[model samples]
Target: MKRIIITCCLLLGVTLISFAQKRVLVEAESFKDIGGWVIDQQSFDVLYSSYLMAHGMGKPVEDARTTVDFSEGGKYHVWVRTKDWAPFPTGPGEFQLSINEKPLEDSFGVSGSADWDWYYGGQVDMKKGENTLVAEDLTGFNGRFDAIYFSTEEGDVPTNDNEALLAFRKEMLNLTENAKDVGQFDLVVVGGGMAGTCAAISGARMGLKVALIQNRPVLGGNNSSEIRVHLMGRVDQNHNAKLGRIVRELDNGDPGNGNPDADRYGDERKLQIVRAEPNISLHLNTHVYEVEMDGNTIKAVIGRDIATNQEYRFEGVYFSDCTGDGTLGYLAGAEYRMGRESRAETGESLAPEEPDDFTLGTSNLWASLEREEPSDFPETPWAIQFSEEYHIDDHKADWQWETGFGNFNTIYEAEEIRDHNLRAIFGNWSYLKNEMPEKYSHHELAWVAYIGGKRESRRLMGDHVLTQMDIQDGVMYPDGSVTATWTIDLHFPDAENSKYFEGEEFFAGTKHIKVQPYTIPYRCLYSRNIDNLYMAGRDISTTHVAFGSTRVMRTCGMMGEAVGYAAYVARKNNASPREVYTLHLNEFMDIIESPLSIHNLPTLPQD
Candidate 1:
């Protein structure tokens, strides 16, 4: 056993120091068996790609294990990157570390720093051979596990700086910075959400070479299994009928917001639709972080594989910032807005009286399932305290469980906001389980979204910024292409809930100022400055008030279809997005009205 273990250790590149300390670095995402645990890439900038978060809803996920060969056999101190999520006395985010099927003396994941940092998990004897490391979740609560460092010396820990960590990761994993070239395409869509997915399909169906890059494994962004937001807003209504056939084809038929099943998002169906399109090159688990620019036009986009950390450069004639955060436009140095405008700035009533950094909050939807038997929940003293006086009575916490309004930038402070949401969910559930045990005896938390369903952020400026006046007055521009059907539904922190959890308002309230379905001008679909750049999704040109009505998934999907159609027109005319709006306006309108474009809806294969 010792001879085989030593040989295996040497063969696997396990570095060893004779008469010195040894270390074994195991990436959590590299676990051989991750069963129900999901990889979190939203914080790729901060946490890197090694982190894995457990979202068991209420049931604990199956243990995740990985085999590692020890360079030298001895007592090793283990450290894991985690946070003191729900920093109450007894944190709900609890997990146990196991080595070679034996539990570690120190129970880890119970206490960690506020940010991503290494927490000590006491020393253990490791045999000089192949051994298994397991991340055992004690509670289904959102316990995040990054990478585990089995070190001979405590001083050999990694720093929290992503750049430094990246250097360390490369050295540890033996990765190179040299990026591979992905073939050029006519159009490249940076996000795989409803907007990006629809944009890719819309362009592919038009016989254009389209490359769809998604940071996660799934196609639907917020609508994916990771986020679980229901498709809202009515499609195929009024002038927008032709624009939403793609969204309808991708719809999974679950109208409810917080369906427990991750499969409810129809991940496979969305993938199949994108796969069926020959012109569309689907790059899943690829995150586009940088853009190459030539004067004003984007030359290419650089991305990194989330799993392998391999870099890739995708070249394209045109690019779409369907990344609801306006990631591409921002990378291309295009003008954009992040928060609410001053009433004086837009001359709109809904605008804040003063210019402020207030934007609509993101949601963390969660639901409980009725179990056959009663379930016991652990005490989470580290979580936010909730009593019957401030408790919400419900089996599901839907879109209303929102946070990160006004206080933080959704793009920059994404991980923080997501952590806050997890704390809120775990904290609230702990309260319900402890205080109202009789009322919630049979209910078990089925699922809670870790990927936030963000409503507004980084609206890329376009030729024409749609305002409240445009929707209320029903002002139809000559370039009117997509019509938004949802009313002006603006979200605010619920006043009653705010009184208790100020600055951490998890409950949201919406004020719906109804308006007739109005047409959004085609000029709102592309960047105002970038020549070949196009945009869709919530990041389109719209005032904060106007976005209230247009930010729905279905509405954004239609906008994607419009952009896709425009991409085809631009390619055919050998014109830029700006030229398509300026010169080919009539041609664009004609294409939208054509039977080939409107009637041809991509459907799932009849099984």
Candidate 2:
């Protein structure tokens, strides 16, 4: 009986192998008609060849959708082909084939045209019974698909020709190796905002080696003159802390010393102060691409300079992500949360009834004016989605024009949104200054920001997430405190889509709570999972409602000082941030109070 069963098993295995040898082939007759042959809309496109023909008139297109059905428990070969001869040439294009939306291992791209049929082939799995097949174009471009043919015969397994997989692996390996070579630093500050700048300066003033990495060309992230957003925070109204003092010293001369335009100096002065720090090495236009880890501790960080195409690897004992976007903390495997939390979770009356993914939107703001000149402005050709005909002009703001309506509001994809907003802004200005010479005849385009001002992104998960209740109750911690003074300001999600104000809605929830400055706990500063990583600015752990109050730049700067000094103390005593918060609380407070002690400036107000 055992012998008979073994023989039956061997025969069944051979029968399955025979069915696996089948192949299906698809071919495109011409590049022009390749559009209908694609299977996946998200991954494929026929615009690459069209773009080459259009003299670079269009952006790369990767749109294609085609589906196939098959029985389960089988294997089949799949391939795509182009006709022997065509008017337009074919280039590189990738196809990602999947079975029942569960991606199969076999997929490849066909490049290099031929006078004869050009074919690229791979294999796919067919589950038991009926199964759906799809081939998606990963790159939007022009390509051809000929036909699909299958065979049911036993044969050896075919080799894969997927270059994309190999290329991706190689890139990851290169990044890993590069990250391992970064040099060491006593302190590394990941963000270049007001807090980050102050942190670096404070650390350097204490004689600690510091490296300040800011993603933007300018130093001030949100309050930079580039964005032109005003600074806000808890300061002695009568004698404002020389928070802007370091900046003044770097502006060739102290502009605040008597210059009437000191406040207008804004970020330029801040940039100078950071750049002038003797112990700080500034890396502007550099992005922290990845973080290297050694068990629980961060080993080093790998960064790329966008302008110079240069890479940096810095090993630091303490790292602070002031990027405001929290890039470093995210890259370092820090725990984080996005969107709004439920009232059940945070125990705040203002918390959302349920969890939500809605976040504050970023803005591409322009400072425009009612012009007195009759000069004509250039006309815009793009589509205009807002108009007074829709009653959007009722609240139409010229100087504060924003573009957060139909796109993602976070800074992760800020450049794309900024472009879209600028086009509309310039287009509207042209109509006002040139087309409507009566009402806007006196109005002129004054200034447009270089980049969109981002509101939120990845918030690092800290030891304790700051809930709206914490802010309402004025919770204080013994570790450290960063005070915030902004009201709970929430913007409507579909403001741009609304006909009432052309879709812009600013809702001050319930009523504005005018509360005295409240302190943010130190636990809200560092990642819960990451041992050596800390974050400041708007990206720190806070409920959506609480963030409405804490996201201001002035408040973020104070957070920077707290974390920066904690980092300095950690380095001096070989301690982690938690240790400094717990054991060396006094020393930490001293540093914050005398951040400019090196410059002989007055101490900060004690807690």
Candidate 3:
């Protein structure tokens, strides 16, 4: 007990402690049983860690409990890491910390600093052998906490500095300084979106060993049940017809945006298809944050398990940045661009007059179902207040219900974006139910996305950045691969929404600039600087104007398929991503032109 407690903590051996004073740092995410609390890693990039969230959707959730054993136990100071998400005078996210079923002195997660920090919970007496710690949610309005720390000394507290906090967490949790080695693969495809999934499948089908890593539990990114966004863009357009074979196979019929039915998204079908591929190693709920660079090439990528906080190192011959935010490329020091491009920069008609941070926003969609009986919704003053005239009077929130525009850094301020969307959803619903009762008497909120469907972020620069002129003017590159057919759809705050909440608008409006089908150049698929990196999806090399057309899921999926086939050429020739185009373009294009076994789509009976 002394050896384990006095020194570094052993997870199985139980208590973590300091030498001078007995201390234990219990990560809330590492709790033994998180009954109703959902593990949230949405803000891990900014916050440095995942936390337990009471996402009971306005109902009190079940308790999250863990057992702790220590050599010496007495009066110990308790510190909880949390924030007041709704920082109004009265907060809705209120929770209690109970030890061995006895409630702690303080009601945590309410009346605290808006930023992530430690909140003091007055000292508690403990037994010498084993004790239980529980977090009981009171309000169910998204109460959250990072970790709970117990110390014999009163003043010794964990640092609020996120960077320093990372080091401290590693020490306390006994996390390895070096990432634990995951098995080697021919290609490591980070981000299990439509693009990355297709990449893995296409690569595996071509007899290449692959690893597909996704941050969420499901394979589909935005199209998954968690986010409920439909797959857009026309697959099997002009150019190589073989490119979209895998994407068409994966489409299980779009349920439309914000569909409440989980089965409609075909989560298990995507999982089964990926699992059926013997050559793929599917890693879900694993977020790749650290990049191991071997000079110009990426040697391996380091990821952490959101639930268990276990670190793993995945080594690969080639890597793909399918992460919509371009997280992988950014980590490898790949040159990337964000925000709208000015007219002078891209020479595009639709380009913004001046370069600013007004990039396409993220959407956190919500939906409601009508019930037979009338339901009661509590007043949410913390949420955005809406009136009859200003309120969006839809039964379900569609793609237009969006945010994260105008100076909002979609990557850094992701959590705020989602929260803002939530406030908008709850507030509008509240107004309708209370103010206009007759219209929405039977309507009840069914689902609201916790995971935001992001449209634009870091655009990893490649050999050539696809511009609006290339698509509209039909400038054909010799290395043209995947065909783009979706309209150049650019989004902005709805004029009516802006009139109500000017700088912080939630509703979105878009204008579609039509363009003829054009093949996207292969040059825009891989990183320009990083030797082994290939990219697909929203993060692919494209100016803001060009990305407006290329950001759709079906198109991105075809891009992934193209990258996969190219990887086969790279592996056979022992070439880099750049060389695949410069040297092996002929061979790659020949393969792309070949016919593929198409899946049978049941057609309607001819009348």
Cα lDDT tens digits, model 3, 1-607, are: 0000111224743236654668888888888889899888988888778899898767889999889876687888899999888777656789999987889888987784578889999899988878999999998788999999988889989999987787788777766556667799889999999999999988888777899999899988998999989999987566887778889888989799999898899899999999998889989998888887888799988888887777778999999999999999988989999998899988988887999887888898888899999987888999999986788788898899889786477999998898888888888888888887898889888888888899999999999999999999878899999999999999998899999999998999999999899989999999999999999999999999999999999999999999988888888788999999999999889878873332322121222
Residue 202 C-alpha lDDT in model 2: 66
lDDT of 1: 0.80
Top-lDDT candidate index: 3
Cα RMSD for candidate 1?
6.3
- lDDT score, residue 74, model 1? 84
Q: What's the lDDT for all of these models?
A: 0.80, 0.54, 0.86
Tell me which residue pairs clash in candidate 3. none
Q: Model 2, which residues run further than 4 Å from truth?
A: 1-182, 237-265, 369-373, 378-381, 390-412, 493-497, 500-511, 593-596, 599-607
Model 1, residue 88: distance off in Å is: 2.0
Report RMSD (Å) for each prediction in the order shown. 6.3, 15.1, 5.8
Order candidates by TM-score, high to low.
3, 1, 2
lDDT of 2 by residue, 1-607 (tens): 0000000011111012223434332222112223434211101111111011110101223333334333335665543333211112333334554556766454444443432232434455666544444445543322334333333333422223223422321221122233223456788998787778877876777667789987666777656655556566554421224333333332332222112232563556676667677778888766666666887678877665432224577788888888776767766777777777888887878777898766766655554455455554544344243344532231133223444432454544453454445445544555555545666666554545435566766688888788777777776766546666777765544433443434433211224556556677878887778888878788888877888788876677767766766777777778788777778878876655555467653322222
* Tens digits of per-residue lDDT for model 1, 1-607: 0000000112133222323436566777667678678877777654555467777755678888777777678888888878766555445667888888998777766663556678887888888777878888877776887788777786777788866676566656545444678889989999999999999988888878899999988888888887888898887575745678888899998747878888878999999989988888889888787777898999989887665456688899999999888988988899898788899999898888988788998888888899999997766566677886887778888888888778767877887787788777877887887788888888888777888888888999999999999999999889998888898988888999899988888789988898888899999999989989999999999989899999999889988988998998888888999899889988889877652553464332221
Give the TM-score of each candidate.
0.90, 0.64, 0.95
